[model samples]
Target: MNMNRTVLYKAALPIVMVLICAPYKVNAYNIEDAIKAVQLNNNGIKASKENVNIAKTERAQAYTTLLPSINLSNANTRTTYDVPQVLPNSSSGDRRSTSLEVYQALFEGGASLFRIDAAKHHLKAVQSDHQSQVQEIVFKAMEAYERLVVIKTVYDFHVKNEEAMQQHLNGVEARFKVGEATVTEVAQARASFEIAKANKNVSSGEITALEASYESITGEKAPQNMDPVDISGVYIPSSLDELMQICLKDNASIVALSSSIESARGNTRVAYSGLAPKVIGAINVNATNIKRNSPYKQDGTTYMIKVNMPLFNQGGIEYVKIKEAKHRERKQKAALESQKSAIISAAVGIWTKYSSSHSTIASMAEAVKASEIALKGTIEESKVGTKTITDVLEAETKHLDTKIKHTQAIQEQLLAVFQMHQIMGTNLSMFTNTRPIVQTAFNKS
Candidate 1:
């Protein structure tokens, strides 16, 4: 029994060791995961959320202006001298009193209503600003993600180019020993190999910087493996006009500015309200002791109506305020137009880049293929003494350059598509499969 148990243990030991020593497989982190992390952990997004909350509180405060104000008061007093009798039996040095009052504004020349309207619009503007902040963060995350992918590709190509150059140099050196290759050929091959190494090092540095940026934005370390962003199915407008129209209507910046303009107009109306009268209605109930230490009491109810009209001020401040508000309204209107023009210009530039990247990518891809074939042919001809080492190295350099360009073009196109969606105020959730934080916050608020 002991011998049989030993044999089983020996067989199981290898399996156990293998399980413990093998590297665990990590899942590939994708663009969706990165964006989700940003939404959950980014400090800027949290701050923007607080701003939205503040705006909501302000709106609620404005609504309270329309509600009646109620007050309850109680007072006790003692005096050194005896009180003079005002009522038939009232002669008290000490007295106690209580009162309850309710007051409501009957009219305020629409100023209160205008202030409420302004608050509502201001809340909307804040919400839109929050959305803009979210979209900006999302775009930056996507850009960083794509940049890492492209740099990795380029780095890999550079490594391959280095290896190929090394091999070519070895071949040239061997031929020089046999007097079949000149010293210049070997020197050229060495230079090309060193250049490839330097290119690889530069790419490595860029990757490190980009990873740090990714962590800063997402509040997490970048994954060792990241899945490439796939933008093939992302929608693009059929025409520039369509894109411009969409941006003017839905872009967060544009929406925020439009709301601000409305808020400014409301403020102008409020300022103008200073020219009209204000009417207030109030009801009061009171009870008071008529005599010190006496059970006898006096009770009364009062109704009052007050109207206030501003005939003039020391400096005509009301008129000055109206003028100031009108100037502010005009400023907002000008800002709105400026924002529209900027958005249109930005949209056109992004569209132009998106449209051109397709052709660029196709052309670069073809160039890569041609340069690859040419390198192979040049290498073969060099071996047969029909091509110099310089020709072969040049072909290798062209091939590497083309491959790098092709990779960059692909990443640029992907980034542009995402930028387009961002500017259009469309939800990135359609692509990310996660609900947008902006929408979630709005719903909660």
Candidate 2:
């Protein structure tokens, strides 16, 4: 039995060794996943969804105005003395009655229809608003994700720089001991090393803060491994004019304002309805007994057609309301135009930044390459006693700065593209294939 157990242990030894030695594959968290998480967990998105529901309920209530109203009532009364009854063949005594009535509006100058239209348009406006809010939150998440990546890159650069500086300081100290370097040179190298160390620490702190921010936005702990963002799949129009046209047509904020204008116009029509005559039709069925003890009862059915003409309101309030509604409609129109202009301006600015950053990346990349070559050459020259340590240190610093700037330029370009998506109201659909959370009944066009 002991021999069999030894043989079993030996058989499993290779498998255990492989398991311990092999690298574990960590799944990379990506921008698409981050966006999906934020959409599901964000409080702002949940609130916006609630607003859409409220608008839907308001729209349903508006449609109910066109339907008939019904009421049923019953009453019982007693008197000390006998009372005469108005209806024929009714005894004089206590009375009990029950009524069923229904009222329907036949016409009010299309006021009911106008109210329905207004509600419909208002629903569209809120839906657009919700879309806009979603885009804003998405942009924020992208911003945070990109910023975290850049900071991480910067932190890595700082760590490398610190290592390089430490090596240089060690060489300087060795040279000083050999009577080949001065005390001032040694101090300078030490100072540069300290600076690099401080920068690394600062970047490390930024990473912690950014990770917390990511958690706050996504309601998930930030992943240790994150895939680099890929912006190549995102599409952008070449010409500024074409992009602007798209923005005007598809931007959620602009769409919302346009819907608001239409809603306001509908409300104005509803206010004008107050000047027209209103027609209503009502039906009533009632049963009454004048004496509770008596078996005799009277039943009646009544039909009514009522018309109310506005000769003059009590204080000309209808006319004032009409004027106020018109003013509100005009205000909405003005606001729409202003929003359009603002969106155009923003589009132009982001386009400019994207163009600049796109060009800057190429130039900065070349600068980094040149700085690397220069630093190498300077270090070689200093080793032969032809160049000073100061020159080598300067080149090293320049190379590091160039690398950082190149990273920043790349981040800026990516962010500008995302901002364009935000302006075009397409960010929500850019990365995912899921259906929209809020939908409106009206056609987008």
Error in Å for residue 338 of model 1: 0.7
Q: Per-residue lDDT tens digits of candidate 1, residues 1-445?
A: 9999999999999999999999998868888888888889899999999999999999899899899999999998875544357554544466689999999999999988999999999999999999999999878887888898888888889889889999988988999899988889889989998998898899989999999999999899988788887765556788898888888888898899899889889989999998889899999999987454556688999999999998997578999999999999899889989989988998999999999998999999999999989999998997787988899889999988888889989988888888888888876655652332222221223
TM-score of 2: 0.89
The clash count for each model shown is 0, 0
Alpha-carbon error at 179 in model 1, in Å?
3.3
What clash count does candidate 2 reach?
0
In candidate 2, what are the lDDT values of residues 1-445, reduced to their tens digit? 9999999999999999999999998768878788988898989999999999999998999899899999999999875543457544544468889999999999999998999999999999999999999989878887888889899999999999999999999999999999999999999999999999999999999999999998888788877777778766556677789779888988999989899888999999999999999999999999998875566689999999999999889888889989999999999899989999999999999999998996799999999999999999999999898889888888989999999999999999988888887888774545632332121112135
